[model samples]
Target: MRMRAAILFEQGRPRPYAASRPLQVEEVALEGPGRGEVLIEVAAAGLCHSDLSAIEGIRPRPLPVVIGHEGAGIVRECGQGVTDLRPGDHVVTVFVSSCGTCRYCVRGRPNICPSGFAARAAGTLLSGARRIRRLNGEAVNHGSGLSLFAQYAVVARRAMVRIDPDVPLEDAAIFGCAVMTGAGAVLNTARLEAGEAIAIVGLGGVGMNALFAALAAGAERIVAVDANAEKLGLARQWGATDTFLATEPDCAGKVRAATDGGLDTVIETAGTIRAMELAHAITARGGRTVSAGLPASDAAFSYLHAQLVSDEKSILGSYMGSCVPERDIPRFLGLYRRGRLPVERLKSGFLGLDAINEGFDRLAEGGVLRQILRPNA
Candidate 1:
């Protein structure tokens, strides 16, 4: 099959992607779903900071890859050995296509399944096969085992969750990454209880979702912090009880002072060392500081060992919010249906495949949240 897709041939392109154009909109050849795989007509794919990180070479992905990790689509075809799902089913893609027999999957920690991680790093489907090629037969790599930046995607059956047709696809797309990672940070990793005081540092799409989750969980004091004043304002409008500008000096100290020596949990979602530093600083003694951000692969953060020991503060790293996609995606969507999650508000707007580069430019500017790409539209 022929389809329109955005292909990233190179990384670390300078800013103003409208000109650098890290991702080239091109027509590519796609293959049918293999055994144990499913073909999907992509409905909506979200532009995320992690995608930007790839564009900026903050994280290295195989070149000439179709780069999109989060999306929702309608299943078009199911390959051999697939019995549960069929054509016309609405589903959301999962990056980690966990092998059920893997130790992590057996332990209910599918988020860290080594099989899924190895496959993504190698830019192949879970079956270890390359399913896309250029018009000239040049093999192309799959991004996150779900190259959803195109009109259609072929992925392992385990990499998707069937959703109700009533759930809007455009809204459901963000659940693949942002909602799962952010909501899981506080609700799953931190296990924040009702009436507990917590703070979300960095109000991007993920951070904003973390805020919403905290609010729905009955957090007594929800402090929202970000370097952008505009984002801070939006956080207040959403549900944050207190908003702080991270750019301000002594920001952490002020938050601690206001919260009577800091919040019970401070979650860092901004994927920056600066944000991680502040998140640790604002955690109360014996409280936990959680980071769900994806910074550069080699980026390192240092903390005073004595302070950690003396305060008895625990620092946790949460990947994909430590989520088991099958169980948590629907749980959060239920919250959205009940009017609690409200992630639809985070949609900045929509774009076509041609504008994907400029979309990243806008996303890099840090003003926009989740920008949807209607690949077939």
Candidate 2:
């Protein structure tokens, strides 16, 4: 099948992406799903910072890739040996395609499954196959095992989870990445307790979801930190106890003071070294700091060695929010259905596939939260 899709062939193109045109929408060929895989007609996909990182060269992947990891769709066909899902079933994509026998999968930590890691590094499906091609017959790389920027995708069975048909695909799309990562960091990774003081740095889609999760978890004080005042305002609207602009000269000091001499936990989702530092600075003694962001491959940060030992502080890296998608996605959706999660509040707007480049522009300017794409529109 041939479908219209967004393809990233180069990185670090000058911003005003609409002008420089970083991602081109072209007619591409998609092959049928292989064994243990499924064919999906993409319903909606979200513009996430991780996708932007690839465009900015912060997180490099093989060129000529379809770059979308957060998406939801309907299964159009099933490959051999796939009996659980069938045509017309709604499902959400998971970036990590864990091989059930890998050590990480056996231990209930599939987010870092070794096979999934290698497949992502090589830009192929978990089965080590390239299912997309150019009209000229050149193979196109898949992004995170599920390149969902197109009208359709062929992904490993492990890369998708069936969802309740009643849930809107646009709303469920974000759960694949931002919501899962942010909320999971709070509930699973941090295990935040009631009455615990917490702060979330970076008020993007992921950080905002963390803020929502903190409120749901009954955190005593929740501080929202970001450089954009508009985002800070949105955080307050969403129930943040306090909002701090990261641009403030003494932002970390203010966060500590506001939370009565530092918070019990701080979650950093900005994917920047500076935000990580601020998250550390605002954590109370013996507190844990969790980072859900995917920083550049070469990026690094530093902290005082004395603080780690004397304060007994701990820093933890959270991938996919340390989530087991099959377990967590349903649980999170239950929260959404009960009106506790309110994940829909994160959406800024929707666009067709043709406007994807402009959507990235809005994302780069920090003006939109989550822009949904209607690839079939």
Candidate 3:
């Protein structure tokens, strides 16, 4: 089957992506699902900063690939030996598709499944196969197991989680990446106690979700920090106990002072060394600093070893919110349904596939949060 999809042929294109057009909309050949795989008619996909990093060459991926990782859709068909899901089931497309028998999966940490890691790096599905190809028969690499930028996708069964049909697909789209990474950082990685105070550095989709998760978990104080005053304003409206501009003079000192020396936990989601530094600086002694950001592969953040040891502080990295999709996606979605997680507020708007490059321009400009891409629109 030939389908319209976004293909990234090169990385590090000039900014104002509308002009440079890093993701080219092309008609490509898509094969039917193989055994243990599923075919999906994509309903909604979200533009993520991770994708932006790929476009900017911040994190290079396999070339000549159809790139899209965060999405939700309806199942069109299921391959052999697949039993849990069938045609017409609504599901969320997760980037990390774990092999159930992998050591990490057996340990209940599928988020770091080595098989998934190798597959993503090699641009194949969990089965080590590429389901898409250029019209001329050249193979097109899959993006994180789900090339969902197209109208349809063939993915590993582990790449999808059956979802409640009542929830809007556009809203569900954010769940795949932003909600999991952000909220999971707070709830799963940090494990903030109800009375513990926490600060979220960077108010992008992930940071904001950390803030929301803190609130829902009954944190004593939730501090929101961002360079964008508008995002800070949104944080305030959404129930941040305090809002601080990252650019303010002595911002870290102020946050530390205001929270009575420091917060119990600080989550960094900006994917920058500076944000990591700030998050670490504001964490209370004996508290933990969790980094959920995906900075350029070569980028690094440093801290004083002596201070860390003396303070008894710890730093942790969270990938995909340290989530086990089968368990966490539904848990988070339940929170959303109960209105405890108001993820709907994070939806900035929608876009058609042709407007995706412009959408990336807006994302790079920090003008939007999570823009849902409606491929069929």
Candidate 4:
């Protein structure tokens, strides 16, 4: 089959993607699903910061890859031995495809499955196969095992979870990454409970979702922090008890004061060392600080070990919100259906494949939330 896809051939392109054109929409050859895989016609895909990281060389990947990890689609065909899902079923893509036999998968933490990491790093399916290629016969790598930026994708069976058809595909698309990571950071990683004071740093799609999850979990105080005032305003609209601009000279002090000393937990979603530092500083004694963001591979942060031991503060790194997609996605969707998790409010708008460069430009410029790409449009 032939389809149009946004392919990133190199990393660290200059900003104003509208000019640099990091991702080129080109006609590519796609293969059918092999064993234990399925073919999906992508309904919608969300533009996430992780994708931007790849473009900026913050997160490097195999070049000439189709870069999209968050998406929802309809199953168009099934590979051999796949009986759990059928053609025409709606499903959401999971960037991490766990091999059930791996130690992490057996322990219920598939987010860090060793095999999954290798597949993503190698830019191939869990089966170690390349299903996309250029018209000139050069093999193209799959990004995060789901290469959903194209009109269609061939992914491992473990890379998708069946979803209710009634749910909006655009809304469900975000659950694949931002919503799951943010909300999971609150509910799973932090184990936030009623009356717990919590703060979320970075008011992007993931941060806002963390706020929404905090409210749903009955958190006592929720402070939203961001460098952008406009994003801070949006946080207030999304039910944040308070908002803080990171640009304030005493932002950490203000956050501590807002929580009447410090917060019980602080979740950092900004993926910056600076934000992680602020998140740790604002956590009260005997509190936990969670980071769900993906910083650059070579990036590092320093913290005072003395304070960590004296204050009994714990720092947890949360990848994919420590989520088990098959279990958490359905649970989160149930919350959405009951109107508890209003992720729909986070949608910035929709874009076609041709406007994908502009979409990244908007993401890089800030103030934009989840921008859905309608590949079939």
Candidate 5:
């Protein structure tokens, strides 16, 4: 079957948005899944900031790659030996894959699974041939482990986590990326103790999820800081105990005042130098500052050596919130079902595959929460 998809071919160019540059959307011959593989008819995909990064050249990828990592859909085909799942299952895709026997996977750190770079970035599944192709005989690269920007995707069976058939695919799409990153940062990385104080800077999809996770973890006070008032307001609606407009001249100072002795943990989700500086300022002695954001390569924050050493402050760069997706994704979904995660509130824009560029535009505008794509629409 042929599929329509967004293809990134060059750097510094806007993602082929206009009709003149409209993404090539045509049918591609389907290939059978190899061992341990499953074919999914993508129902909904997310326009993640990382996709923006790929377009912006902050993170470069091979040309003509289908660029989406967070997606949910129904299984269409199951390869040989796939006993645990079957067709018609609703599922979400995970970028991190586990060999299961790898040292990291054995240690329960699937995020650091040894083949992570090759497994996700190789532009294809472990089988070594592209599953998506053009009728004209061209091939498309898989942008992460799952090139879900297309109508159909082929991925490792292990990369999928089954969800209740009733939960809307749009709501589940963001879980693969933003929600997992934020919520996992708290539940796995920071693990904010009961009643601990936390401040999350940058309320984008991931930052907002972090705030919600902190609340779930029993943090007594959750102070969320963001320059955008719209997002700050959303943070409040999503269980942020306190919301602070980051534009305040002394916002970090106010954060410190909100939690005497400073915030027990400061989550720097903005991935900006300014946000990191603020995170350092408001972090209490022995507090851990977890950085979930990905800033530009040259970005840096300055601080006195003595301050970090004497205060026992630890700054950690977290990738994918240190989550084991197989385990955590299901748990996150359970939280959503129980009224704890509130996944539905994160939807800012719902668009079709052709509207993918507009989704990024809304996200860049600074107020939108998460922009989702319905490929089959």
Candidate 6:
């Protein structure tokens, strides 16, 4: 079978970059899954900021790569030894794959799986091969192990997370990335205990997810801060107990005031130097701040040495919610099923694969939550 994809031929252009635009939709041959692999006929895929980052150079990668990563679909084929899944099962594709025996994987962190640094960023499978290619006879890079922008994604069986067949593919797709990263930061990494006060800065995809996760985890007070008032309102629906519009100078003071001096946990997902600084200062003594945002090259954070030494404040950088997909993915799906995660709030709109460019526009518009690309539907 031949599939369609949006390939990044080059980089360093403009916001959304040439990578997001001029999407090349062509029929690409569907490669058969090898051993321990599964072939997925993609139904829905989400356009994440990370996808935009790679294309716009906020997050750099090799050229000629296919962009979308968060995808959900049905199992079209399964390779040998894959007993857990078969054709016709619905699943979401997780980009990070673990060797399972590595130190990180054994310790329960597949987000930083040992083999990922090389395999994922190189746009190839763990076995050093690319599964997606052009029908005209050219190779396409599979960013983050799954080239989900294509109509069909060929991925490892480990990357496929089986979900309830009835869950909407669009909702299931966003869970693969944004939901896990945000929710995991709170549930897995922070382990936010009940009655604790929490603040989530930057209320973007990941930040919003953090708020919802905090609510589900039973935090006493959840404060959401953002420069955009529109998103701050969305934060409330996602379970933010308080909303603070971050504008002008000294917004940190407002955050401190709202939290009654300092918060138990501060989650930074805005990816700005200012956001990082605010998060650091607003955290209470003995409190911890978890950063899930991917800051740009020019971003920097400054703090007084005594603040760390005397106050006992700690800062943590989280990747993929410190998650092991095999475990966390299913747990996240469970949250969605029970209505604790509010996965539906994360999505803004849906578009067809040919309308992929419009999805990026919605992302750039600032108020949009998440835009999905529906290929099969």
Stretches > 4 Å off in candidate 2: none
Per-residue error for 60 in candidate 4, Å, reads 0.8
Clashing pairs in 4: none
- List model 1 lDDT by residue over 252-327, tens digit each: 9999988999987999999999999999999999999999998899999999999999999999999989998889
TM per candidate comes to 0.99, 0.99, 0.99, 0.99, 0.93, 0.94
TM-score for candidate 1: 0.99
Candidate 5 has its poorest 10 consecutive residues by lDDT at: 15-24
lDDT tens readout by residue for model 2, 1-377: 99988999999999999999999999989999889999999999999999999999999899899999999999999999899999999999999999999778999999989899899999999999999999999999999999999999999999989999999999999999998999999999999999988899998999988998998899988988999999999999989988899999999998887777788799999999999999999999999989998889998888899879999999999999999999999999998998888989989999998899999999999988999998998
Q: What is the lDDT of candidate 2?
A: 0.93
Candidate 3 lDDT over 142-249, as tens digits, reads 988898899999999988899989999998988999999999999999888888888999999888888888988999888998899999999999989899999999
RMSD of 6: 1.9
Candidate 3 or 5, higher lDDT?
3
Per-prediction count of colliding residue pairs?
0, 0, 0, 0, 3, 1
lDDT computed for candidate 3 = 0.91
Q: In candidate 4, what are the lDDT values of residues 1-377, reduced to their tens digit? A: 99999999999999889999999999999999999999999999999999999999999899889999999999999999899999999999999999988789999999999998999999999999999999999999999999999999999999999999999898999999988899999999999999988899998899988998999999887888999999998888878888899999999998887677788899999999999999998999999989998899888988888988999989999999999999999999998998888999989999999999999999999979899999999
**Residue-wise C-alpha lDDT for candidate 6, range 1-377, written one tens digit per residue:** 67777777766555453244645667777678888888898898888888776756777776678878788999989888789898999998887877777888788876788686688778787767777767777788778888888778888877768988889888899888898889989988888998888999888778888888898888989988898999987777767788887884788887787667889799998877888888887899889989988877566787888869899999998888888776887888888899988878777877877777667766766777778888776
Candidate 4 global TM-score: 0.99
Q: In model 1, where do residues sit more than 4 Å from their true spots? A: none
* TM-score head-to-head 2 vs 6, winner: 2
List candidate 3 segments past 4 Å from native.
none
